[model samples]
Target: MKFRHLRNEKGISLLEAMVAFIIFSFGLIGLAPMFSLSIESNVIARDNSFASNLIKETIEEYQGVGSLPSLPFEETEDILWTKPTLSGESTSSESASRTNIFSRTISLEDNSTDASIPNGVVQINVNISWLNLYNKQKNLSSTSYLIES
Candidate 1:
């Protein structure tokens, strides 16, 4: 019977471990921008969702009544459609606070010119604009047609 002596081998060298760490760091660096972009996209999506809800609610309010005013009217948080104004202009009507970042504007256009629709039909256009975290201007708009009942 012959006995053989086994030598101990190093599991990992310091150089190998450092190289692995460097490679992992590079991978993380490559993914860093994607993470930042994902956060930015999430914020933009949230703002867009809020704007969409605002527009929908405004349209529903008018549609719920099944009636639209003959003249152009604007509605905001502070001012209602019932308020009489010299011109159909509104400022930051969607949000009550003046310090709000978003500015919502509603405009109405008479669509009676379109012979296809009814005589008392009007087109409602809602625009929402804001400055994003990046200080860039972002805008969302929606249009709906309403007929006087």
Candidate 2:
């Protein structure tokens, strides 16, 4: 009697398994574009970080000088950055080289003439621009104040 009952019971057929597999594959295929998007976002974020750092360093360099730069001054230059290897070691011959060039502009403004601003105060503006991985133009800007001692 038990054997007869067991024979009446049915298991999942091969066709059902194949259908489930197809459904799962379609789901994975839908997610394929997300991987590329994530990588692109990461590259953009890295470039932005580098640009911000360059602006910060330029501001600090000007601030640390013994004499303040002349007001209404403007200068632009190209910045070169080299990518570091994954091993964190420098090899002269076996180095993999990747370089990025960023354009930076610095301008100074005299704010002492304005009644709202205190005397002997200068405004510093720094702008950094770069072409992203997608060949798109992106830029960042920063402003700071310097007081004459």
Error of 2 at 112 (Å): 7.4
Q: List model 2 lDDT by residue over 9-96, tens digit each.
A: 4788789999999999999999999999998898788889999999999989988998875666889999887766667666575542
What C-alpha lDDT, on a 0 to 100 scale, does residue 131 get in candidate 1? Answer: 66
List TM-scores for all candidates, in order.
0.65, 0.77
lDDT of each: 0.70, 0.84
Q: Candidate 1 residues 1-149, lDDT tens each? A: 99988675759878999999999999999999999899889877876777788788877877787556655676544222221334655644833432335677887667444455557777777887776667788888898998666
Lowest summed lDDT over 10 consecutive residues: which window, candidate 2? 1-10
Q: Candidate 1, which ten residues in sequence have the lowest lDDT sum?
A: 77-86
Candidate 2 error regions (>4 Å):
1-11, 87-97, 112-118
Model 1 clash pairs are 76-93, 77-93
